[model samples]
Target: LIQTFEKNNDATIRNLEAWSLETGQQVYKINLTGAILFVQINTDNSKMLVATNDQYLRIFNLQTGHEIFKIKNQWSDAQKEVTITPDFKEVISIYKGNNLIVWDLEMGKVKATFTTDNPLACYTVSPDGKTIVAAEIFGKLHFLTLEDKE
Candidate 1:
């Protein structure tokens, strides 16, 4: 669950607070240097990932409040549009101005990546978790299959 403290401008006054649904205890607190672009709470509610205008991504342990991972260069677009997999095991972040990266949460590595030919319209993952498709300008689409990953 997410609770926000608002400033006079109606922007978030401070870092957002993450709480447990059952007990309502503070699980994590996330701060942003700039506007937050992407915010995700994992399926099990054990992890939360925050993406921001700072071009940084950080993963925190919901229970212990420890930072488990931090990554940059995962997304490059100042547009700051990112989507997390429903299962919370994968992340799809696109910074179309420079590149695109799809990451594996467990390994914390690039499962696949590609540079854009032109500006990107959008990106999507296959329902089975095996493929990623990105739509680009001029009605072009790129498909990357991960079913054969070793």
Candidate 2:
């Protein structure tokens, strides 16, 4: 899958395209709002989580191209990256260069937050969704463990 952007004078428009690597042809395109920052498809390829510059985290049904959930952000910094747990119950995002946010997919609310002094560059969730390794711009790695408080 490939994501392409179309720039206009007002806002940056985004188009999500699925391509065929073997035939080198475009399969289909899905038009989306705002500038997309990160996209993460679920393990089953049935759903996707997209984070955009418009400060919205959207979850879409990949098969029907229908939006399932939309969560708006209150912060100012752009989202650096986003990932979904294997169970598709949680969405984790890194932003503001120093903050990590975990969102509950079903409830459409923030579940937890973590902050660091250094700017974060990237992150990945463990296969079991129990741990997160976030890399800082200064070459430091932070390992975070996720727990169910409730």
Largest lDDT belongs to which candidate? 2
Note the Cα lDDT for every prediction shown: 0.69, 0.78
In candidate 1, which residue pairs clash? 77-95
User: Which regions of candidate 1 are displaced past 4 Å?
Assistant: 5-14, 20-28, 96-98
| lDDT (Cα, 0-100) at 73 in candidate 2 | 64
Model 1 per-residue lDDT tens digits across residues 60-93: 8866657899777456545666766666777777
For model 2, residues 1-150, the per-residue Cα lDDT tens digits are: 444555556666576776656778776676766677778887788887877777888888776667897999644544445677888888887756688988888899998899988988888999999898998889899999988876
Clashing pairs in 2: none
Q: Residue 146 of model 2: what lDDT? A: 87
lDDT of model 1 at residue 111? 70
